[model samples]
Target: MAGTYHKDESNTVNRYKHQATYDVDTIHAIVNSTPVLHVSFVPDTSVPVPVVLPMIGQIGHYPSDSESHCYLHGYVSSRLMNLAASPPGIPLCVAATKVDGFVLTLTPNTHNYNYRSAILHGHGTVVSSDEEKLWAMQLVTNSVVPERYENSRVPPDNAEMQSTQILKMRIESASGKVREGVPEDERKDMKRDDVLDSVWTGVIPVYEKLGEPVGGPYNRVKEVPEHVRRFVDGENARRWTYAVEASRKPAPVKRVKKQNQVE
Candidate 1:
């Protein structure tokens, strides 16, 4: 809320200037709350093609570091690890989006989504420090489900530690856009007698709802663990409440597009 990311050409929002935010806290919140993040990078492959990988990541503030960086992990990406370990690290882009509701308008072109999105640009380096890596591993684990790391197997053993690699992407800039509220249409459409009578307009709430826990085959515990149950219940309630509330907010002011701008 207090510290904001400096806006620059790379992170500036030209189109919905009103919804764009460079707030550090807001960007972190959007990323942390989203279940998955898409990280894109270029690899030195024979063909040299861009790769977009879905990863589990969270922004963390370590006591040793002056600024926060996103810790990344996924099904072992050895190539990315190698790139990160190289001098100066590898350039990376991380994006996350959470859909709150679907805005239905009189016409299809006016339909839109209520959402929060963030884009981060940075260079990622492999976290070589064992202490920091361990801490980051725990941080990512808990991000998925609170207290999951501590509840699971204690400090990772030699094999686990050796096999896992975590990346610290020192964020250079971040930009976020948030869209909420109900349906909005042009004045012409709003005043149309025939069109207005024929069409339905409103917002349909959307959210990621966690279902009842199903125990694994090897799970001998009779009842669901307190942590697991708590996370399921808590996430469902929070996500649903936000979605419904967003659907009820006042619609965003419809702006007239410039003659040169395309819809």
Candidate 2:
């Protein structure tokens, strides 16, 4: 959807309004591209402390659904599964981040990382419908490698389905922030020839590199599958391209919120 997510107290950008985005496509893109999403929720109301889990998740629309939803693959913790199964669901936060480059500045205070980050706040409930569950399962499986569900033994067995679980999160609010550029230094340092001569200012481009695939002991496939080969090669190129591009852009200006910076 081209429509943007509504900004409210819950989703407002406090400081970096210039880099913050409420666009639906931008937020979804950041989430989908990240390898792992950190899902956090309060496990016990009495304790009021949140539990964070590194989970595999993807966002997409189901055939029968009116809007897109976030689906999480949760085969790890039974406590999280139980909490997500209740009616009306539990409050959850999902965060994804990709560090593109490291911005090294003249001073430590201005040092930062070029990155893309997204946060989604939603109510997550167990996917009870078998048909929807199946679709979500496939949605998550292919997220790792394109067309993976079709390329492998799929239509999960009954036992596999029974053991696995999928949590559907109806997003209430979402937002994203992006930082890309070389380095930013205060005028005080920029004018100092000594600091300029001694300090190095540049960006170290960072990207995830996919290594050669190794087959498991039981795997009898003669060569790497087409889907696997394509995804690995394509992702490596895309990742490097983005990191380098982001590294070359003009440095971003700081817009710190008043009364927030400590002495």
Where is model 2 poorest over a 10-residue stretch in terms of lDDT? 254-263
Backbone clash pairs in model 1 (N, Cα, C under 3 Å; residues 3+ apart or in different chains), count? 0
Query: Per-candidate RMSD vs. true structure?
Result: 2.3, 2.3
Give lDDT tens digits, candidate 2, residues 183-221: 988888999999999999999999999999999999999
- lDDT agreement with native, every candidate: 0.90, 0.90
Number of colliding residue pairs in model 2: 0
Q: Over 4 Å off in model 2, which ranges? A: 253-263
lDDT of each residue in 49-87, candidate 1, tens digit only = 888989999999988888889999886477777888875
Residue 78 miss distance in model 2 (angstroms): 3.5
